[model samples]
Target: FVSEAFRVFDSMPEKNLVSWKAMIMGYARNGFCREALKLMYRMEAEGFEVDDYIFATILSTCGDIQLNEADSSATCYLETS
Candidate 1:
């Protein structure tokens, strides 16, 4: 499913931040937190500037799954980056 989304995204003529955010959020919502975080890191490493909505979605995912570690990591990521 994620691979399909990435395929579509790759085909897009102009990939925007919203597109990336949507993909990341979709992954997180589907219990793919590791993929979500990995993609987020990849995006950052590629110099994409993430916005508030991205952070909010990740935090929400952590809360939804009761992952304290993820929540703390998200909070720390937000604070530091």
Candidate 2:
């Protein structure tokens, strides 16, 4: 579960940009659009410098967040091992 990943993330003594991106992408890819967006804002609040990857990753998920509930349930349930 991504919750497990977050545990590790939370414990990090330091987080670089890639760490933020990985967590954001995990939340996004797991259909947690709001979480990803919130994390993006949190990343900004933490004073990390933004790059093209940040914009691209968050921008790519705009449509995901806009989906109606029905469409979201049907379209965004990705299974993982």
Candidate 3:
């Protein structure tokens, strides 16, 4: 299922924040925390704006640890949302 999910994700013509969030959240909830977090970093690096859902989902990966470890983009979203 995850493999298929990634297959679709990789084939996306143009991904917005929603698509990124879905894939990341899926991986996170399915015990693929590392992959999820890695994608989150990639998302931020790609200059996508994070929203409340994205921020909360990312933080849920490992409680305050994820937030503490999040880069400036995530913190910016946290402050705003």
Candidate 4:
């Protein structure tokens, strides 16, 4: 399922927030926290703002993985979100 999702996502000529949210949530729900977070970073790099829903999902996913509190990127999101 994830692989198929990745294939579809990769093939999209232009991805919007909804498509990114779906992929991120799908990965997080499936125990792929790392992938989800990676996508979030990529989303930001592409100039997509991580809204509240996406932010909450990411926080939950980070909790599940026990993400390091000292990680600068994580701290930045925590502070800004």
Candidate 5:
């Protein structure tokens, strides 16, 4: 489904942040954290701005996994922002 969506979006003459966000969020919600993070990194590398909401959501997902270091880092990021 996500791949199809990405195909459709790519076919569009104009693309925007929201389109990318939708793909990222879909991956996250579907339990594809690695893909989500990869996409985020790619977006950053391409100079696409990531909004705070995206950060918060990704952090929340990391917290849900309860990985010690990841949770701690997420908490730190949340607290500092």
Candidate 6:
């Protein structure tokens, strides 16, 4: 489903904030935290300003992965986004 979701997401002509958030959250919920982080980066690269909810999702995803440097990673994510 995640892969399918990505396929659909990639095919979209003009992605907005909501779609990006859904994809990121879906990846995180499905235990694909790394993918979620990557998507967050991609979302920013595409000029989508991640909102507070998305930030929370990223933090939660980082927590799911038990990242040792969650704070630093989040700082980097925030900076990039």
Per-residue CA lDDT of model 4 for 18-70, tens digit only, reads: 89999999987787766777888899889999877886786676674345542
**Candidate 2 residue lDDT tens string, 1-81:** 999998998799999898998998888777776676568667877998556675556556646534353244323322210
> CA lDDT of each candidate?
0.75, 0.68, 0.72, 0.79, 0.68, 0.79
RMSD from true fold, candidate 3: 4.1
lDDT of 1 by residue, 30-63 (tens): 7777677777877777779877777777767756
Higher-lDDT candidate among 2 and 3? 3
lDDT of 1: 0.75
**How do all models score by TM-score?**
0.71, 0.69, 0.67, 0.79, 0.64, 0.78
* Model 3 TM-score (2 dp): 0.67
Question: Of 1 and 5, which scores higher on lDDT?
Answer: 1
Q: lDDT by residue for model 5 over 12-77, one digit each (tens)?
A: 685579877887788777666666666776776677887887876766665456335455544564
Ranking by TM-score: 4, 6, 1, 2, 3, 5
Using TM-score as the yardstick, the better of models 2 and 4 is 4
Model 2 CA lDDT for position 73: 36
Candidate 1 Cα misplacement greater than 4 A, ranges: 10-14, 64-66
- Residues 1-81 of candidate 6 have per-residue lDDT tens digits of 899999999899999888999999998777777777778878988998877888787676667435454566677766764
The top-ranked prediction according to TM-score is 4
lDDT for each residue of candidate 3 in 1-81, tens digit (9 for 90 to 100): 987998999899999878998999988677665567678778878898655676566567645444455445456645654
Q: After superposition, how far is residue 48 of candidate 3 from its true place, in Å?
A: 0.4
Off by over 4 Å in 5: 9-14, 62-81
* Candidate 6 Cα errors over 4 Å, as ranges: 69-72, 79-81
